[model samples]
Target: MPKTCFDPAASMASAALSESTLSGPTMGTRWAVRYQAPPDFDHGALSRDLALTVESVDAQMSPWKPESGLMRLNRSEPGQWVALPADLLGVLARAVQIGALSGGAYDAAIGDLVNAWGFGAVRDAPDPAAIRRAAASHRPAHLWLDIDGERARARKRMPMTLDLCGIAKGYAVDRMAQVMDRHGVAHALAGLDGELRACGARADGRPWAVALESPQEGRRAAHGVIELVDLSVATSGDYRHWIRVGSERLAHTMDGRRAAPVRNPVASVTVLAASCMDADAWATALLVAGPGEGPALAQRMGLDALFLLRCEGRLTEIGLGRFAAHPCRARIAAATPAP
Candidate 1:
């Protein structure tokens, strides 16, 4: 469940651009693409190119799409080699890198557990037995990616599902940004849902100001803010898409280690990475790791991260050293009193 928020107030110069919404299944959720390009940009032509990019990726990678190339491979009886798309192979390789670096805190094979806990395709409360089974099956190490001569194979016969929601959006954003850059749109922002990548300034000389949404339920105030330029930002939190199991509340974020919802003081984590995919994956990883380990990991990885924790019904900002330097002036001013 990813959401996007943009401050159109930040864009200055208005161009004659075409806008359209493209809806489809991505990252186990409905994806709505709101694309804007120059009016002369040829809506049909641009849509065709972008749609083909997305569809080609989905055909080879979507586990939900039964006839997808990945499904074909998953359903293969045994010891069968299914040729993989270059894009899928590239994504899997990066997933492996993140999984290893984060000590398995970030995983691509946690799909079954996510679904069992009412967080994926089937949104129903799962029984203890089902949870246990799903937990046991949530290991990225079990999956194999052998890129040999344009073919990739899963070495093990265990049931596996690859949900790339954590990283796919960022990758797509990056790809779209590249497309725009190639067309000489040096100053534009392209996003899918709120995972965004910005290029140059927004038709002006100022950087994009992103409001960090307060994690408080039903509240719309900015907890903080950050100015971004030529970078991507992704945030993950437990406040949305959660389930109540008895007296305890469970979030959609699953800890691959225990295959259960993470209980941490860190209510939300926002990461500034070179790519939205990296930011997204790191934000999830840090949130699961909790406040202490999260900040430490961010420091080690040289990431700009801000952690928000709810204390006594108030939001507190806890930033790694780097984040403090890039504070959102609006939020800081709001926190200050008039003399």
Candidate 2:
């Protein structure tokens, strides 16, 4: 493990959000907003504004929200074009772009399948035959968006549900960071549910230190740590949000191709990218790709990725060339003994 140091004095206050926060003992779970500007940067107000922006977008886009624009469109007759807000249109375009790049591993139109699997608003044991039928209607290609007019319409009569849970938070983080930057916040870190972006080093020029959580049970220490500046990191793992079906455990992440839970020994995969959306989608895609092919794909795409595998109660890490250059803090201590 390589040791990367972050200055505690410069660490910003973390805001609680949907995911658990384990970066620091007191951090807990929240949407953290840290900025390197005036002490009275109005982060609380900024967070509230960002949350409202997200909520408004959700109201217009989330299929789970019955009153959302998407649901309204779903209920409306065909040939009816629903006017979309600019924000919703932007996110929809991003979703389509990522879906195409990842080969549908990360899809926003899988709301029906997600609901069938009891992962969405409606929770029930889904029938295999029904699952296939629901999945057939969940293709992203069926979605049509006119960015200029901010309008969206589905070509098929099939009920189309859009769930932005996969990429929304990361996109929110980016938006919030923009807000901070506009306020002249030179050094800051915006993170929501482990998807984080570090704008720059602290005022003193110290890089931000981020730790990767161990995927194994009863392991409290970080698997690794990295010093970052102007970078974004996101992790996806089966350890969280999983259900046991018979003797096998299934993760919430589904392979759009097979319409089944990913069966891979890979415990977790973390990615560092230019944006959280890229990192978030790539993390899910790699998890679906499994261990062997996942790392290779990351390399082929010229991405920096770290893979952690659990074998016999221990964690083994495999890093691509780019990720390997970063030192693993935990490993360093094990190799060095006290005098």
Candidate 3:
């Protein structure tokens, strides 16, 4: 018999369950699932289902897709009640809620600003004239977007372009978790891009470990690891997607209030929440809030977040809520063992 990768005693009783992993492309990135399943299980069908799940989300919410449900609403007339898919509507509603809670720091109605800054579908260089217009015309979605849950429709009180880039990916991750549960996979890990959720403990009775990425551009290294058991975590940072303007670097994340890329010393913010959607949005919100009010907001909201701030050319980790109890230390180069 083949040896189980997990503890022998732990797996002896559940010998039918075998460790499995599945991955596919999504949102210009990739999604991965790890789980223990029966040897006879049809993993091929499950993999296809997972791919279709994420593809459905992209079809409904992708700003790059001209025929996506989100873009159709974007092209709709102001004050028009546009019909939207249930998933898109729910995500939009939640995005607005988070935007209000974050004091307009995480608005979903920044599509125009995003495009003007060359981060959206256009992907062109930032246009100064369009940037100024978008800046002057910026409005928070919470104030103008109205949702009719009963009718599965929404209307914009003012003219605005809805962008779910900040929140939809996390929602997709949540959906993937749901798909796993429906498939009767009790212990699984679902992830899209960097957003992740653990369904249960590992086969060895240990939590799934996820790496905390160091906020360094053009380099990939782990700052630490998070042991997750039935929890979700996400990180938002400027390191991954940014454009250099002379000496200034502009991140892809837009600040709706400022109508510009976030300008702060916060290198990144990682948030742990019950749902990946909340984790993803809050991460972006806190990063937009910067180090000052971000910690305060996290305290008030009782959120567990780690803010990696840039100070004197070194990384400083600020923990809130549960993170404060067990602080994660940044790994220094001097401490690394030489290869």
Candidate 4:
């Protein structure tokens, strides 16, 4: 499906039963599946299949797993041709495309850089030289994929340390949705971490309402809510997954241009797209683009994004494209680009 622009008035929902929820753990986080189960559907078997699917994806892409496919590739020498599974290959391809389109803002090849920043399990700061070397290795520029053969190779001398942390969960959500579809289920809201995808509607005929969290630190309040059907939404924020590097606190999100986490004035970015993977990738890209360029870039790209910027100790929000129609829409911060 192509990317879509959300239209509130035009977006309606078809009714379906909402019953039987299943959830489990994956990729260091929890995944939930809320769906309308068919009468003949086996809830127990469906749950197992869903768990297995998520486990397979994690084994293929998780950097924390030493024996994972991505970690194996990372251990391989730069010139080595790694035989990638279809899932990893597809994610690499999409990551490369988004990285190129975002001018390296959405790079997946900065896995080593992330680890060096002590954002992984380690807490101490890494050597300065390692960080510099990691920054020099950009995924879109160096990772080569042979789509026809279903394998990929790295053209550079660095290891293939590609991290799918930003987008893998979204793909997992899509897979959950696929699983639900296969089992003759409908009206599902599948989510992993900060990404969510919804389809059809509840028995009451109302679309799923997703809450957007406020970007403030230590706050768990919802800033806005939007009704969505058959659409995926993802948000990237610096509020979580950050490490304090001496006096400076650095986020896990890395920017290839600076070879460091984005230092932009933006606090968070939420993107709505046809697919959860695209939404996840674009949310990171838009957050890295920051307030100055994000709104303009989002406008030009026809992307539906909601940006929360940190300005002078206060957070200001700006909505682009369809986000304007979101319920609880805040005052339009002046820095937002004109539509």
Which candidate gets the maximum TM-score versus the true structure?
A: 3
lDDT digits (tens) for residues 1-339 of candidate 2? 334466555443322112111121111235665655554555556656656654564577666667776676556554456665566667667777767766666666666667777676655665677687786765552244223332343322444656666777677667766766765666778787788888776665566777777664434456667666788888898776776667877777777666666777888888888887778778887877887888888888888888877665566677875577655311211211111
Which regions of candidate 4 fall more than 4 Å away from where they truly are?
A: 1-18, 38-41, 136-160, 325-339
The clash count for each model shown is: 1, 13, 0, 0
Q: Residue 21 of model 4: what lDDT?
A: 84
Q: Give the TM-score of candidate 1.
A: 0.81
Judging by TM-score, tell me the better candidate of 3 and 4: 3
Number of clashes found in candidate 4:
0
Error of 3 at 338 (Å): 19
lDDT of 1 by residue, 136-227 (tens): 76556324433343455443245566666677777777776666666566666666656776676555345567677667555556665666
Task: Report lDDT (Cα) of residue 199, candidate 2.
Answer: 79
Instruction: Work out the TM-score per prediction.
Output: 0.81, 0.78, 0.93, 0.85
Clashing pairs in 1: 4-194
Query: Candidate 1, which segments miss by more than 4 Å at Cα?
Result: 1-39, 76-81, 142-159, 328-339
**Which candidate has the top score in lDDT?**
3
Model 1 — which ten-residue stretch has the worst lDDT?
330-339
Any idea what lDDT model 3 has?
A: 0.86
What residue pairs are clashing in model 3?
none
Error of 1 at 160 (Å): 3.4
